[model samples]
Target: MVVFNAPFDITLINAELRRHDLGSLEERLGAETAPVIDPLVLDHSLDRYRRGKRTLSAMTSVYGVTLQEDAHTAQVDVSMMLGVLQEMAVRYPRIAGVDDGALHQFQVEEHRKWADNFGSWLASKGRVDDISRAWPQE
Candidate 1:
């Protein structure tokens, strides 16, 4: 499990958008098996500066994460957050990073890992190559 910690609320919003893509465990994993991995808030130290009544600089505070559950414990992985960074880089370059290629690669890797594990699990349960097989291909 990889957890994504953001420096502020805006970043938390960014994280939520990312969750919409990779961690969409609604169908294959089943609602019971999947934890409600949503945007979260927490108390953390922040280094904020005032700029004409607006807060600026390191907005370290609440963050969100996607988690994986085992028989007993849960885990967080930072890799899950790479998608958020990708989305942010489209508009706000500062949210993720300055490098576009790095972000794209991160997203691809994240998707492959997530799909491999989750898809295999779904297939093991005799769900794969079932409903989708009947659909027409273009």
Candidate 2:
């Protein structure tokens, strides 16, 4: 599934599914875990040179997504996300053709790289705390 923030949304969904005795999402996917396309990770990887925030709104603006109204609702947010993905695919065509497993693995590596860079930057700023590089949690 494609999501803006895979970790947060997947965690909440898995927790609720587990609470209802529906089994974990991974089990339902017939794999170790569900395949996910994380736009946040993709954006960071593709536009590492770009500046400013990476919020959904910020991304929509960067990708030239036109919002008819506020994007507080899930429907609006999802639509905007799809639009952003479309723009990304146009700019980075290989992303659109990657197989599910390969795409999932790519996101995993990208997330790790982003985390490591962020940790190092934090260290450069005098914060010497360890950063958890785990993706989508355990």
Estimate every model's Cα lDDT from 0 to 1: 0.30, 0.85
TM-score of each prediction:
0.27, 0.84
Instruction: Tell me the tens digit of each residue's lDDT in model 1 across 21-129.
Output: 6342233344422111111111111112222321111111112223233211322233334333333335344423434344433433443444466577788888872
RMSD of each: 17.5, 2.2
Off by over 4 Å in 1: 1-95, 129-138
Top TM-score prediction, candidate number:
2
Q: Mind giving the per-residue lDDT tens digits that candidate 2 earns over 60-127? A: 98988986487868989999999998999998998989888898898888988988999999999999
Write down the lDDT that model 1 would get. Answer: 0.30
Q: Best candidate, lDDT-wise?
A: 2
Point out the worst 10-residue segment of candidate 2 by lDDT: 129-138
- Once all C-alphas are superposed, what RMSD does model 1 give against the true structure? 17.5
Clashes of 2: 0
